[model samples]
Target: MVEIKEKGEFRYIDEGEGDVMVLLHGLFGALSNWEGVIKNFSSGHRVIIPMLPIYTMPLKKAGMDGLADFVERFVETMKLDNMILVGNSLGGHVGLIYTLKNESKVSRLVLTGSSGLFENSMGGSFPKRGSYEYIQERVEYTFYKPETATKELVDEVFETTKSIPKCLRIVAIAKSAQRHNMAKDITNIQIPTLLIWGLNDTITPPLVAHEFHRLIPNSKMRFIDKCCHAPMMEHPEKFNRILENWLENEAHKAA
Candidate 1:
């Protein structure tokens, strides 16, 4: 549904026109993660989703700072402005760090199932690497419905986890995110923010969303019932509606 364009070292999907909206995926995320947002908003917004180098980044630089730095370079290289950053899970953490460092460039922020404040991350219970059943269970844990954890989705995660090197990088990035909390710095965010969370998110959970809403001064919160971590995938329609309404309201507020 979306075409990924590569320029230099960055691989991204750029579609439509008008104000720019950058979509950042989570730790084990793929282009499919933001598929709904791209198709829904590309008509009136320039949607951009960068393929983050989670498993490919150098081991030494495989951390939150590394991901945030990559985003900085991508923004500078693309010359993006008046940006609305939409991030999910770890992506949200990177967005928070990005906005904190370059708040002047970001006009608004949307975070769903983000993991800056707190997360379970299995408490270091690394996925049973070669176990398909284990990986399937973990993937299903992300959604309210078990069927939402489609066979293809489970297979993708299983394949990724099966790799030893990839597992190392994943652990490194996950640990860094866990260690780096955003409590003190989130208060510094001055731009308008939106928190879209799954009411039943297990990893970040609903309390995390409450904490985010409580900490960030200019922010709004919306919860999707019977949804888990990735609402965009499980309930694209509802997710897009909440996002579209917020964006429209933001436009009106600006006008």
Candidate 2:
């Protein structure tokens, strides 16, 4: 276990043996967000989850922050090579950007309700505002089923928001939002990719998954029934099964 700072924020990280798998969390999410997923994978693979620093503090430097650079620094700092990338929501978007910019580091890629893939897929992205209420509303939209949207879920997100200042949150989104066209960059990825989407996801809908599959070469899409944006939390068993199957197949193909 090791704790390190990249771009001025502390991130918790753990390293183990087997094929390396880097787990990336969504916007407003820290490494803790992927705790369950990491537990499941760590038994079989080396897992590394980096806390994205951009979404932490309230104040930030001006202009769009370099997401690509952050990823580069992370890879170099960890001394990682030839690994699979698993990212959810905004993390998925970041994973895609990192792979696109540094294809040499990635082996296989998996994205869950990934944000960076589609522009108009989910009734267009959220509005260009930074209010806590506005952010809360947008965050709520990421889920597929309203029934599954509970008070606890909303409160958890609220807690994360309260931890980070409004200004920094706005800057992170602003920089990511500035380059919303992930489709154009998909062609750059050479590694085989897997996309898992929630069937009920309204934020990044099933249609977005299909579009990503259609655009990215050598990519496959799987939709989990009754799940929304956060499938790992909403449906962990099914999500794990899907991941296990894809990984096994990828392993066979490589052999």
Candidate 3:
């Protein structure tokens, strides 16, 4: 647990060493969300987990800053170069934005249940299907097993929601719902990219993955069974295997 707040109010956790792998969590999520997958990933890669600035605040309004700029500063401040960016859900959106802006810094990109994508050309507006109830519905769609959406899961997500102040939550939600055409930027990105989706995820849905696979030139898509918005958490073993295999393939290709 390495803490460095030199860059705003963010602390970075460093684990393992080799190729740098930066992990960013989704909305209502902090760095801790990666606790389950980090150990498996750390054996062969340096993992840098950052606590997002927006979520770190208690009652402050989420800023209007674009995801790309935030990532640029975060990477520059950390001095991380030639790294892979892995993001889940909202984190995926951040990773995509960052990669689009700083292509040279990323060796590869992987997104699990990422959110910065849409099926139609309309790139703005908060998800009408974003409320807690809507989130539950979306979760049902993203996970193949309905049992996964148990009361415990609901409570866990509710707790996560409560962790953030209402003001920041509203702002973050609003920013996400609003429009911005990141797809155009992704289309020009030539870096290696991987899109992982939970076949059951209704929030972003598999169609969102299809959109990314369609736009991003060098990209591939994989679906995790019985998982929803977070395959890395719900199905860590499968997630790790796929991630390692992809990394290995990337290494061989680079060599």
Winning candidate number (lDDT): 1
Residue-level lDDT tens digits of model 1 in 1-255: 678899999999999998899999998899898888888999999999999999999999999999999999999999999899999999999999999999999999999999999987853377778889888888888889989988998999999999998999999999999999999999999899999999999989999999999999999999999999999998999999999999899889999
Is 1 or 3 the stronger prediction by lDDT? 1
Pairs of residues clashing in candidate 2: 144-200
User: What is the C-alpha lDDT profile of model 3 across 1-255, one tens digit per residue?
Assistant: 434344554477888898899998865456666866778878878888877765443333353244445667778887999998999877787787777667899889998877766522112232232257754653444356766566566555555545435435545644653454477678888889998788877567788889989999999899987676778777888888888888789889989
Global CA lDDT computed for model 1: 0.93
Error of 1 at 107 (Å): 0.2
Task: Please give the TM-score that candidate 3 achieves against the real structure.
Answer: 0.80
Q: State, as a TM-score between 0 and 1, how close model 2 is to the true structure.
A: 0.81
Runs of candidate 2 exceeding 4 Å displacement: 1-10, 56-65, 119-140, 144-153, 159-168, 171-175
User: What TM-score, to 2 decimals, does candidate 1 have?
Assistant: 0.98
Scanning candidate 1 in windows of ten residues, the lowest lDDT window is 119-128
The 0-to-1 C-alpha lDDT of every candidate, in the order given, reads 0.93, 0.72, 0.70
Better of 2 and 3 by lDDT: 2
Name the better of 1 and 2 by TM-score: 1
**Please, what is the TM-score per model?**
0.98, 0.81, 0.80
